[model samples]
Target: MPLPRTAGSALLALALASVAVPASASSTAAAAADVRYVALGDSYASGTGAGSYSDIACTRSRNAYPALWADANDPAAFSFAACGGAKIPDVLADQVDELDEDTTLVSLSIGGNDSGFASTMLSCQYSTQSACERALRTAGEYVVNELPGELDSLYATVRARAPHAEVVIVGYPHLYKEGGLCLGGLSSAKRTAVNQGSDLLNETIAGRAAAAGFAFADGRPAFAGHEICTSDAWISGSNVHPTAEGHESAYLPAFSAAVSGN
Candidate 1:
């Protein structure tokens, strides 16, 4: 796998220094390369509420994992087929021409929805209570049971669509950390439980991806300490999207790792 870019520590500096050179110079950096990249997932992959995309029509945006990977790699070489709030079936649904025969890389961050993670979180209302913790735990189990079949379908779909592509499935970032609750009076132990639940889903992602002949980027560790409720917030608005900086700091690592071919 390509490992996350340590060079990102220096990317902002390069972009800022290059800004004075004019549009043409920036255009050179933005130009597409000859690699095919495909992205499929929910809001984290959607770039929703991040205010970046080709346009509003697709509801898909530019800061999602695929676009971030593209910016790091050759732009022309990549394509973003990910849609916001997408489920495993949704990925199966989108007709990704870009994901077809020529794709060089593919990454997906999904399964949280199947776990009813969003619904659970919403019910907790960001509280810290016993009820909330149990909900998260239940949601996790749901995801564990559901993801394999869903992921198997996804893998088959990719194989049918992008036969030669190196498909990479990106796992979930930790959603809760340090006992911050979905509501009032929740235990920190539940925080650990919810995170563990999310981890279970990740393991499922890894297993299924492996079975289907695809690689999975290790995002949980990379995204550690940067959960949706993290002090620094790596996950974007709620349970869906990732912030622009969040993608840079969190999701981008997985993509970079895959591209590294390490």
Candidate 2:
């Protein structure tokens, strides 16, 4: 549940809204001057489906995009605070403490789990049409109405913890290839609904990132030809998580560009 929209929360929201966009030149300079990088968020950031897991609980993987990026860049100080199945509250409790004034770069992919993505997909798979639609509707409502405030609070917490960090918010990818090449037993229409939901997710992330002056890394182009249902799909059969190839090929490049201020 979101915090009560009381006077305190309202003031916090205002302060957070002012932080949506960082000064590009200064952020770029800070990003280069020091490299105390931190990674935070949910399953995508935790490398759930990607192979070579490092921690079972967090599911940090050598192949996860964050780990790969850390390896390539060799940041002076790096903390991988993301965990499998993390929601906004989880990030607030477990991850934000990793940030500090010395932190320079941060990358995150969150809010999907909060939107009940896994449950919604299960409902779409096993429930009747009406039931699936209801589930999707609930998820969409959470994304539109509730997620922004939660994200705003979380972003504020991160910024306060590391005031100069060049934060990067990464968005989820479309899961389907369109047409009749649908994966699993989902109807084409259902696939389209799921993909649309993903678009909503990306749009929400992009908007919030812009509001906070953070860079938004889009995953769609990287996953373009390899969405689920295609022979070249980089996503795992689980559908909710990306495969190792997906992490390496899609998320890694997108995050690299974001870090480089491209």
Model 1 stretches with alpha carbons more than 4 Å out = 1-34, 55-59, 126-130, 179-187, 228-230, 236-240, 260-262
Q: TM-score winner among the candidates?
A: 2
Could you tell me which 10 consecutive residues in candidate 2 have the lowest summed lDDT?
Answer: 20-29
Q: Which candidate wins on lDDT? A: 2
My TM-score estimates for the predictions, one after another, are 0.75, 0.85
Model 2: how far is 118 from its true place, Å? 1.1
Residue-pair clashes per candidate: 24, 7
Error of 1 at 219 (Å): 1.9
Write candidate 2's Cα lDDT for 219-240 as tens digits: 8888998987888989875656
